[model samples]
Target: MPPVAFLHTHILVVVLFLVFFAIKAVLLLLNKRDTLDRMRSKTKIVDIVLGILILITGGYLLFLYSGRIPTYLIVKIVFVLLAIPLGIIGIKKESKGLTVLSLLIFLYVYGVAETNSLAMNKEEPSVAPITNTTTELPVKKAPEEITPAEAAQEEILNAMGETLMANAKAIYTQVCATCHGEDGGKGLGGAALLTQSQLTLNDRINVIEKGRGLMPAFGSQLTPQEAEALAAYTITLNTTN
Candidate 1:
């Protein structure tokens, strides 16, 4: 199945799990022990099934992730693990404190996942000015004084540069646009704003090849030359703006 299918299924299972817990907690709070027990008896199999599906789908998504596992995602997983046992023990022992704690943790995890943050805050990503690395080119012979061979070589080099930039733009759109946006300021999923980046050209290439934080490594997907070209193109974004 496609990743989207698994994503949808995971969402459905999570909602159902939350609803089940909500209903049970409500009954417990209302002192409807008998009703809660009756519902639990009827849904024991469902509870187990939901737990399995959550783990299966969540694990699959994690496996599909191209980057290093994100911090928020790791934290969310830990909370989920903690909440499940707390919930089971709470319901089994009829402990309102434990049940409520478990429910709150589940809610917190949900928020973290939605915001892609540990603090659950969706703050705008800040842009930093890029450091200038330009240097004066060595003095070239006057155009009229240049040999025919040198002129042809220069022309070929210019064409190659343009071609690389075009390829880099296409690659960026195909692989990085979803998170970085077309102009590189979208910052979705914690992507760095390219226009605001402060890294030198070489540093940008390293980051693209190895990745940092939420960005996935493209070393396997992009050649070193391609990585260099992409880095060069990202620098242009800063200059153009």
Candidate 2:
């Protein structure tokens, strides 16, 4: 299966696991012992299956990272490992304290993964200046980092228009995440690692609008503005200068 299929399967399994756990936790907290027990008995096989699926799918997705894993992802994985056994034992023993604690940790891990931040905040725009060998230069800020005036100036410079900056994250998630992966380090299907990309902004835009090697040109699928937006978003994934 393709990496995107694995990504989708991982998400679906995780959602089901969270919802199932939440329901069981609520029933236990409300002292619905009979109902909880009956539900658990009926779904015993399902519970095992879901657990296995979570591990299988999650492990496959992690494998796509190819050693360029981010710090937040590592932390998320640690918490998930801690949460799973706690949840199982908590549910089995009817311990409210452990159950709640495990649930909280799972929720936290989900947030951290989605936001790509330990603090669960949206990542700040990657506007930090790149250090030059001989002289300091202002690195071009991401679309989200620019003021309205700066955006207008950018439009003049690139002629892609301000709409190119709007909803870039959403665009990247929908159109680029399959090959690039979430943080752009997946390198699946021969996709380049965006985090280590050294291409300038315009060059990146050209690649997105055109095509390089195994990657197909998205020009027909995306408007010029949308293509530019995706290019700008990919720049934020660059961690290496």
Candidate 3:
């Protein structure tokens, strides 16, 4: 399949799954047992189809990231692995809690999928240097200490950051390079030479995300961080040339 088609199907299947789960969650919450039962009976085949598509499409795409999977994707994979059993168990046991939990999990995966970030409320903390230790052999500067747990988490985020830059490079090559040229100085696509662009980073992000005139809108095509990375990458084109 074409990259665009592959991406489109991947997105559409996941969105449809969310809608399917959301409807069921609402029914369970509203105590509409009879309605929920009827809908279940009618939608079983269709739901199966949706689930199959998600697995097939998702699995096919997974091969592309074997050595380069990002941290957020790891979280998403875990949730997707749980999704099937959660659905079956939730409806069979008529557990409102499980149903609600499933909805929230899916939403989190959605946020991570769309934004390419952990989407956690808290930021990962940086390592701090121990200061002013008493009885030190010397009054020298203290080396930074990173707890083992914090180090692992930082490693994951750093890998995620690397993944973002790699993605930005790919996006620039495949989407922007044709017009901006490899050096980003050519305007063959009638695009403003990215090297000469005076737009602020945010402005460039806005234009890329929303598009202007001949440019295509990437708001839905690229994640926010990916857009930001691409904006940053464009500036490097000038330096390289």
Specify the highest-lDDT model's number: 1
Q: Select the stronger candidate by lDDT from 1 and 2.
A: 1
Over 130-162, each residue of candidate 1 has an lDDT whose tens digit, in order, gives 332231111157868876754553343344466
Model 1 CA deviation exceeding 4 Å by range: 124-241
TM-score for each candidate, following the candidate numbering: 0.56, 0.61, 0.52
Q: What lDDT does each candidate get?
A: 0.75, 0.72, 0.65
Name the TM-score of candidate 2: 0.61
lDDT of 2 by residue, 1-241 (tens): 8555676787788889889899999999999999989988988898899889988987876776543577877888789889989998998999999999999999998887666678977533254422221221124677587667545534433553344444666777787877777777665434677866777666877887776644656788888777766776676566653
Kindly report which residue stretches of model 3 are placed more than 4 angstroms away from their true locations once superposed.
Answer: 120-241
Mind giving the per-residue lDDT tens digits that candidate 3 earns over 115-175? 4468643222132221111111111223366445434433433444555666777888898
- In model 1, residue pairs whose N, Cα or C atoms come closer than 3 Å (at least 3 residues apart or on different chains), thus clashing, are none
Least accurate 10 contiguous residues by lDDT in model 2 = 129-138
lDDT of model 1 at residue 22? 88
TM-score of 3: 0.52
Model 3: per-residue Cα lDDT at residue 120: 44
